[model samples]
Target: MIRFEGIHKSYPVHGREVVALHPLDLTIQAGEVFGIVGHSGAGKSTLLRLINGLETPSGGTLTVDGQALGTLDGDGLRRLRRRVGMIFQHFNLLSARTVLDNIAFPLRLAGVSKAQARARAQDLLVRVGLEAHRDKYPAQLSGGQKQRVGVARALATEPKILLCDEATSALDPQTTASVLQLLDGINRELGLTIVLITHEMDVVRRVCDRVAVLDAGHLVESGPVAEVFLHPQHPTTRRFVAESEAIDEGALQEDIAHVAGRLLRLTFTGEDTWQPLLGRVARETGIDYTILAGRIDRIKRLPYGQLTLAVTGAQSDEALRRFAQAGVHVEELSR
Candidate 1:
């Protein structure tokens, strides 16, 4: 578990001070996968670094699993880091070491005997499905393989917390999916609290339980991933969600400019998504419907639907009322 109270960070630039992170208050529950998303220079990396004491906060305090980060001394910080492992976007492995040795490196640094380290590394290799590549060097393995080694190494310590800094950003889509699956498995099996930083909302949708959005070092939004993804409130959060769905609200409005009737955006979640709400409402009200833009999909394990429609006929208002009665979220785009 981690908690941030009025935590802020800044750096001196010439005679002036530049803030990288505004005072932020956040909580990351134990055994939950929490994600931080923002654009470049948004201080996402800075926030991640602060968790591990890599960057000292300029003000306020950070409490990680009951340890106050600001109170830790050099040795205390080092000990804390050993219990909080981190993986990088760029696989930072020793090129001279083989995959087996690369994974064993952290264990060895932690004072494990070479034999014990190698044995632990061997187990991690199989866990990550990279046992067959253990004898290969960093250069000899594929991008995915190298990241697996990085993941294996990060898990070598069996830390209570795992920090993923764009862990899948460098991989292709397929590879990214596979790596994300691996992270999810680790979270489920080990109950490791994961804090990952990424610009991709898709990553958050697939793996994170909760997410926080940042803009210019300011915390814009934070909540359960489904709530934030489904009904984004902040401008930055809305932009991220819209971009992830590849639907521009302005463009959608323009496209439906000539369409008749009230334009409504209906959102359905869980079993509400599966019910024949649309057909039932249409038939009951004799409202003719024209589908515009929409999608039926799952967010994490929960099914959801978002439909933009043109509803007409004399009973159109009644159709809208029926949609709400069926537990559908309706937004009047045009009426």
Candidate 2:
């Protein structure tokens, strides 16, 4: 429901124009959780702002729900923005207002009657599991609680799209997981199309259906999360995956080189049990195999499995061919 075509943004610094986003072309489908990941200067945040009209592009087009952003005037932009909600790294709540009042503030600004706004806020408090904390002030609540208030406030107007700019960056790991789970529930229940921008790859892996990797203000890669994780094409994408898997590249390379037989990295997904394939390879090829480092996890409720194995003797190639026939991806590692 959102599209950017050849978008570019530049700012003048010390009389030199610095490009923040470079000719970005992207599409975010309706009801999908899309993630943008990059380092600090990669312009991920700027890209989000462009969608909400907070930052106008220097060139190219941005459209949401088929309306070109470039054509919107102040009133049009304001009306368009009402349908888009945003939450920031900081909770950005009004400290003086209680949790209930903080959430009602947005609705009230939209000309909703005080009683109606309070009713809506109360409902949201319950939805976000903050019913008991409605009377608490920002200082009286924890970081996660404060963010919940922010989330409730953002949803007060029932926006179709939510832009999360490092929304969980300030919280601890446990709290982050809780907040991410809440977001996931919101997306599933409300069909809210979410755009999450963060440096954390785990966040994308956990909640995002599709992800885009940006570097030096340019789009490096974009695709389904599982596909990207399994077969990363860009160097930056590989680094992100490696970091998430905690792979010791230097040590892995050394080990692969020392192996006396063929080394292969095998990847499997959904319903394709590794045990059967391993059994078949061993029984058919007579190649001794040793399992190295790898992992298995669930992605979108589907089994995702990876294994690194060493196969001895000339039978290694035959075994790998069998694995391929069995629908397993085998990537040969350099010796």
Candidate 3:
């Protein structure tokens, strides 16, 4: 339940104004896991800060749940911020505070009674699977555990929306997966709306329901994760998806040329089935197929498949046309 219309934010740099966010307009619905992705200096972080009033916009309107954030003063914004929680990459916990106390800190700020806060903290510790480590300090906990404490603390206030600023970036791959799973669980169970910003497409692929691509302070693309992954429009979006696929374009091209065959890359989504298409192509067309690389995975709980094939036959064009007629995308690689 957030809307940003014609939002702009700029700063003075080297005696000239630099735009960090260039009049972006976006809407995030309630109970949705939305992702903002881009490289560094893409203003993704800046956009998140604007939502929480950490950075005021230079022009235009920002509304949260129908309330205009731009009109709110310091005290009003403070009150509104309680309904929004944020988690950081570095697991920003007070090192001196124990795990339980760290979670309790937010409740304390909100003037939650000690006994009530303790009960809430205990429940959160248990929720995050950190009940046994409640007495341990931040330094004693592992990176994942520390981040769990951060999550517990962020949830302490029972915020409706959670802002994750590269929450999994600092963790190892295994730990990152664990943390992402936790976020997914929270969103499903609590119906909490989560807005996550990260450079990793894998993270978005695993957890995000919808994603928005930002580049040069502009909103380039936004849609369901599966749709965006299957048909990326922007250059940056295509690059991210290609990199995530780990496609070796140069090598694939060389192999295709040397083999004196056409290289076709096909993507299959939920509506289309890959096995039937592969079978039909083999049975109908006399072309022999060499599958160089391929993968099938889930995005937002939907099947997404990709295949790279080298076809050797005089009827290669016919085979490609068959695939296209069957609604499969066929991209031919250059030599």
Residue pairs in collision within model 1: none
lDDT tens readout by residue for model 2, 1-335: 99999999999999999999989789999999999999899999999999899999999989997799999889999988889999989989898999999999988998999999999999999999999998989999999999999899999999999999999999999999899999999999999999999988888888899999999998999999999888899999988888888899889877777667777889988889436788777888888977877888866556779888888866888888888988998898776
Cα-based TM-score, every candidate: 0.97, 0.96, 0.93
Candidate 1 minimal-lDDT segment of 10 residues: 326-335
Give one digit per residue, the lDDT tens place, for model 3 in 56-175: 899999998678997888899988889899999999899888899889998998899999999999999999999999899988989999898889999999999999999999999999
For model 2, the superposed segments whose C-alpha errors exceed 4 Å read: 273-275
What are the RMSD figures for all models against the true structure? 1.2, 1.4, 2.0
Show pairs that collide, candidate 3.
none
Please list the C-alpha lDDT of all candidates, in the order they appear: 0.93, 0.91, 0.89
Taking all chains together, the TM-score of candidate 2 against the true structure is 0.96
Q: Residue 234 of candidate 2: its Cα lDDT?
A: 99
lDDT of 1 by residue, 3-41 (tens): 999999999999899999999999999999999999999
Worst lDDT run of 10 residues, candidate 2, spans 273-282
